[model samples]
Target: MPELALKKETGLKKETRSEELLQLVVFQLGEEEFGLDIMQVQEIIRIPEITRIPHSPDYVKGVINLRGKIITVINLDTRFGMEQKVHDDNSRIIVAEVDENVVGMVVDSVSEVLRLPLSTVEPVPEIISTKINANYLKGVGKLEDRMLILLDITKVIMEDAPSKVAYC
Candidate 1:
């Protein structure tokens, strides 16, 4: 049951579209895996140098020059009230489109793109002990050995935005 051996056993490749599910891009923050709609993801890039903007919230990591366009980067862990982590070489920025605007999210690592069928996706249940609000989550999805929290990206961002940002 060593970590490496367990990974090897679970790493067997499968056909991309197995007629049951659509692919999702998976990434990690702390110990949990979360997913966003694959079609919403523009690209994954290395941690870029961000220009800090004064008067912004701690979760707003600042802007990055992506091919000459400035995009805001948000730290998911911080937004969720988790302790901030120091960035390392393995850290990544996942660019996703919401409300026609491209935003980058920082994650500890990108795991894989998985194809999950509609049947495997379930409504987010009303769990009394859940720490985060349900508006930020679309649903819970079950895949082979994992359960992913599918994010409603637009809602997540909108819920935290200032009145000015929300209308823009």
Candidate 2:
């Protein structure tokens, strides 16, 4: 008699190994690295000229017109309680969807797209740096030499602000 094999998730017979992986768009802030679920990322682009929003917190970098649509952008540095750094050639804006809204977040640089087994992601640990709100972290992704701080996009975008932005 032959033994039947099954995939770890989804009781269906295994066809290919591709569906069992998690994808992430990795980026950097100051000296730390972070990641977001790839599905939340729309696109990444070079930092553009941003128009200041009056009375808004310093973290709110402002807005930009991307292909004729105005999108609000924020500074990840300030949002994480770090000193704001001037935009350089390596800086970029990662456009993403959070809670049904579009937002562009500035990062030191956009790194590579990482794909790994879903099991490699672990729940948020008890202690982390004080700069970012732990509620904003999805989990800590374990990699070979480093750990990727996975972000909860909705919280990062909606909670860490002067107030809920009223962009239409």
Candidate 3:
């Protein structure tokens, strides 16, 4: 009876630990995979015609009207200094809330919703090199086959205060 109680207690602890997992919306940007906290993502939609804003920052792709809400769109490729690629059928806009502002991030494609244990995430290694600015990275998530670059969406969207997109 004591051994049975111990097993039950161990199972409960395991369940509690699993609850610490980070749920992410994973997407592809060029050849690399990136993830954003799922809580920040409002929705994912197919790419729509975007209205360009003249004199906007180079990284700003422009704005899209999402059900009467004008959401500013940022091209992650341009923002990360990667070669821009033409949008295709797989291209998607991830609508996420950052710094109290809702914005759309254009990605090559959205892969899947992944739940990774917090223990699997590691701080950015000093030896690792990448095109993305370190300040925009939260951490690197290790998976069985590949690693996922976890982006700090707040830093990516709000880095330039003066150039912050104003939504109506």
Maximum-TM-score candidate: 3
- Model 2: per-residue Cα lDDT over 1-168, one tens digit each: 123333334344353465577789999998889998999999999988889888777677889999998988988898889878778999999999888788999999988999857788898878655678888898888899999988998888888452445372
Candidates 2 and 3 compared: the better one by TM-score is 3
User: What's every prediction's RMSD, in angstroms?
Assistant: 8.9, 3.8, 2.2
lDDT score, residue 70, model 3? 87
In model 3, the worst 10-residue window by lDDT is: 159-168
**Candidate 1 local lDDT, 1-168, one digit each (tens):** 699887775564343344466578998888888988899999999997888777777778888889998888888888777777787887899998878878889999998998778788898888635655788888888878889988888886667674323222
lDDT of each: 0.80, 0.83, 0.91
**Superposition error at 59 for model 1 (Å):** 1.4
Worst 10 residues of 2 by lDDT: 1-10
Residue 36's lDDT within candidate 2 is 87
For model 1 the TM-score comes to 0.81
Indicate the residue-level lDDT of 163 in model 2: 48
**Cα-based TM-score, every candidate:** 0.81, 0.84, 0.90
CA error at residue 74 for candidate 1, angstroms: 0.5
Q: What is the lDDT of residue 44 in candidate 1?
A: 98
